[model samples]
Target: MTISAELLPQHVAIIMDGNNRFAKKKHLQKGDGHREGKNVLDPIVEHCRKVGVKALTVYAFSSENWNRPQYEVDLLMKLLEETINEQIPRMIKFQIGLRFIGDRSRLTPELQQLMLQAEQRTATFTEMTLTIAVSYGGMWDIAQTAKTIAQLVKEQKIDVDQVDVDLFAQHVSLGDLPPVDLLIRTGGDYRLSNFLLWQSAYAELYFTETLWPEFTTEELDHAFGVFLGRERRFGKTSEQVQQEKIEN
Candidate 1:
């Protein structure tokens, strides 16, 4: 499953799903499944880095996840704190920039501080950017960006007529990076689940039944292979695209 260099996705986003299902199937505690899922991220990030991916965004915790049982939520927060503490050194060693995109106000003060420290410590890294979405929702991201833009307008910093698709997008999450080239969802899910709505507008979507903890590097290569086989026409016909390629 060697993906052609030209077909490799520059930015890949993942919806990590099926942690609870994986745990249930193993007859283990849900927390254990989450821990395993968290462990899987490091290897996947390493794979992405080795494969020349510029950015990888993972859906870690959603804003709607707070509706779960309190104990589970608490366990998740604890896991996040511990994972952040452990990954900081690895990130620096690998030269991977660590960043979080989401509403941080809901995160514990300690976790917030740790996240900030991780981001600051790896700010100079250039190998790859790893973005974890915690307490994040696509709708929330869009709304927050709109709010910020509205504030600027109110302050007379910008005119309403200046607002366009590009201007609006500049305020959205991950606005400075390349648009998502591929979006992978595991655990048999077929939906985006409110993850990166604006950024994934034209992304190639891949879904799999493999649980997060069990999704392997081989599987990732398979996804890339599939991506390479697709003919991306955007809005043009296949003949038109082929003709343009030939002319170029």
Candidate 2:
């Protein structure tokens, strides 16, 4: 049966965590887990497309990840380059707009060029959007937004008194898309881990014990089911919301 798009989240952001733990459990190297997790990404993306999800954001790497072993970091960079190069054609073919949110200044110039190429190639796409959060931290995004707003203030583009939530949101990286409706964290983690701190302010949080490498479409559905069972009051009483709808 085709799941109703309304039942599926319009925008879902996932923190792809627990790769190292998954690897350790399987008696494999840490990078091996990440490699295996990479294999699952395409399938998850396809599942989101199938479910009519408008936008999907994945926490691929964090700004703090730079503290990891240099060798692992180097391997991850190579993997990121290879993955983007391999996936661009597929993304374009599938009409999935590709977006990257993070500090690209930390990436190698070659890799940064590849990222730009991917974004440009898929810019015309209007289907689903797949955003990878690489070298990203929610605090960094917020700080960057503040810095931009400060610059705008200096330029006299807007009065400092006019700064508000909506204006700040406009400067966020994923602001063009719908606010995050669901946020998923896998591998037993129960925290946001600095992914989309602003966007997920009212998002439904779903945590699964399944590792990223083992997470499947069925698991995705389970998360959706969980979300569907919730009541989104959005700061209003249920009775108040119902009454407002009735009045409308």
Candidate 3:
């Protein structure tokens, strides 16, 4: 499917799912599925950059994911560390800016340092931004932002009356980037799963049964094709939107 250039999403966020299921289906260890899922991300990211996506945010690990078996969690952390270390060169080569969102305090110092180093190394890249959400949750993001705002208010940095939706949003994760234009969740999930509550307020959502390990560029194009067919009216009626477009 050829997605129209004009209808391409500026920012796309994905909730990658079903790695374990894919592993079980293949009669392989769960870790193998995660490894495969990790491998698939590079091509998808490259495709997004090639197709002019400005930013791509992926839900890597959620705050709730910590409750999983210790072995699995440890393997995931190890994979993340190794992937970050390995992807830096590719990110530089592709001129992609690497950024991480989520609470960093929970990460080991080594992993945190590696993440920071990766961000610093690719800080000058301008072609596209790849944000990995590890230990992240939509509610946690909101609460953290609110806490920051509360601190500022206590410090007399801002007045209580000054708080508004826009003002409050500025403190949330990815506050500097464009709002999520499309949110894709793989593995047949229909719910947001506390992925990006504040950022996806009006995002066009696409859910697919394809597992993360098998989600390909072609599937991505299909999602974009669907996105192009939808009419984004925001709060306006279709007639009003069409008339405004004509007036413009």
* lDDT on C-alpha atoms for all candidate structures: 0.92, 0.91, 0.93
lDDT of 3 at 15: 96
> Highest lDDT: which candidate?
3
TM-score of 2: 0.96
lDDT of 1 at 178: 87
Ranked by lDDT, the better of candidates 2 and 3 is: 3
| TM, every model | 0.97, 0.96, 0.97
Write one digit per residue (lDDT tens) for candidate 1, span 43-162: 899999888889999999999999999998999899888888888898988899999999999998988999999999999999999999999999999999999999999999999999
Model 2 C-alpha lDDT per residue in residues 155-189, reported as the tens digit of each score: 99999998999999999889899999999999997
Q: Residue pairs in steric clash, candidate 3? A: none
Candidate with more favorable, higher lDDT: 1 or 2: 1
Residue 56 accuracy (lDDT) in model 1: 96
| Candidate 2 Cα outliers beyond 4 Å, as residue runs | 244-248
lDDT of 3 by residue, 208-239 (tens): 99999999999999999889889999999999
As for candidate 2, its clashing pairs are: none
Could you tell which candidate, 1 or 3, scores higher by TM-score?
3
* TM-score, cand. 1: 0.97
- The backbone clash count of each candidate, in order, is 0, 0, 0
Off by over 4 Å in 3: 1-4
